[model samples]
Target: MIFIHPTAEVSDKAKIGDGTKIWHHAQIRENAEIGENCNIGKGVYIDFGVKIGNNCKIQNYVSVYHGVVIEDDVFIGPSVTFTNDLYPRAFIWSEEKVSKTLIKKGASIGANSTLICGITIGKFALIGAGSVVTKDVPDYALVYGNPAKITCFVCECGRKLENFEDNKKDNLVKGICKFCKKEIFINKNNFKKWKK
Candidate 1:
């Protein structure tokens, strides 16, 4: 049930899973692995060595650069940009230890967020639109702004859930991850997060 458009250029080395749909003008580069039921929108550029998991949604004009490993059911919003170089240099291979950015399962990134390399965004974490992520984000944490900070805890239901931040007892919430406390919200329609 794959729906790849004719205008799109998919490399032979790329592995596209069943039920995946590559839209108009989208390009999946060599060695890119897209999982089942994923919807790659128009003008999306999936770079080499990038791996996307099942049921993911990548919107228009987004760049999934090399060394990015996106887990299952993640939602990448429109115009989202992922940077692979920490301190980019034209003359040298000075990535400055630019490690890979790992997005765990069920995370939802808002439109136009910029993810800096070497940062591991926690599972089920919600990154707000237009954020510049610099460091590691915890799971189930709702973050925003230039150097993305935790503002609230988001439920898997797309509601702003209660935060046990002030609680003296350290206990795990049901359906949420241990680090971020993000609930396991699988996308209903096609793996994209719905704005509540």
Candidate 2:
């Protein structure tokens, strides 16, 4: 059974899975689908047509707008915002121009990050606090800054790899994760994750 706080407002058309908890002052719009065991924190606003999968946790004061799809085991920190439309037009026919964004499975965004429209954040990607994500982030990558640049790769255990002076293949500069004690190898072309 889902647990919705009395202060939260969940629309009749919204579908909340089992064991999901909507905390104080949260608002889930019509047609939104939140999966099982999800923790929705205080003052979250999930807009129409938004889809969130299992075991996701959204922290306080976040606004997840339309055209955003969140996969399983994702952690969205406090005050994180997801935007849909690039331009603002209240009474205009601009809804057709809205671009969708996808946050793949196991991705985590730190507090106060902003995800722009039309971007797909890859699986297990980590966005640091106060980042403004303007482009697609690769899987298992740790990114920071206003425009969001790849600083390094972080493991599931949450440790950044150390840099080695010799043997570049064994260094964190090459995007190896120390926490998981594994190497993350990417294809030669686009530097996308393949998990070596």
Candidate 3:
């Protein structure tokens, strides 16, 4: 069952999957696709053509504009802003000027983060609070700060992979997570979680 608040403006043309809940004053524009079990928070605006995958938790006041795609299991913290236009002009309106931004599966963005357009946030990556992301984040990376630099590698469980540097040999690094006891293999920019 889908529940939309009385004050929310959800277009009939929008595709809302089952079990989705749209909170107060949320506006889901035409052609926007929201997958199942999503929580569209208060005052959140999902622009036309935006695609959101299943189980996404979009916190209060988040702005998901056109040209943005969020994959499944993503958590967008409160007040997060996704900008589609690289340059602003009050009189200008052009779909060609909007840049694409992708938030891959299982990623989490902390509160008040700003994602500049035209960047891909990789799968299972963690963005700390108040980050200003401007580049493509690698998978399982923990990135934060004004420019969102990758500070360390993290597990899918959101625990830091301690001493990852010590396991590097050739192009692959293998380590056992202390918290979850799961084995992980990192091959350059790609990482995989395996059972022990």
Most lDDT-accurate candidate = 3
TM-score of 1: 0.82
**Model 3 lowest lDDT segment of ten:** 187-196
CA lDDT of every candidate: 0.82, 0.86, 0.90
Candidate 2 local lDDT, 29-70, one digit each (tens)? 999999999999999999999999999999999999989999
> What lDDT score goes with residue 147 in model 2?
92
For residues 1-196, write the lDDT of model 3, one tens digit per residue.
Answer: 9999999999999999999999999999999999999999999999999999999999999999999999999999999999999997999989999999999999999999999999999888999999999998877788899988877778888898865543545776765578997766556645443211
Clashes of 3: 0
- What is the full ranking by lDDT, best candidate first? 3, 2, 1
Find the 10 residues in a row with the least total lDDT in model 2.
Answer: 187-196
Residue lDDT tens for model 1, 1-196: 8889999999999999999999999999999999999999999999997999999999999999888999999999999999898778777774354569999998999999999988887777899999999988777678899988777656654566642332224333333445546644322221112223
TM-score of each: 0.82, 0.87, 0.91
List where candidate 3 sits over 4 angstroms from the true fold: 163-170, 189-196
Tell me how far the alpha carbon of residue 190 in candidate 2 is from the true structure, in angstroms, after superposition.
4.7
**Candidate 1 C-alpha error for residue 65, in Å:** 0.5
Candidate 3: residue 94 lDDT (0-100): 100
Stretches of candidate 2 exceeding 4 Å from the true structure: 162-176, 190-196
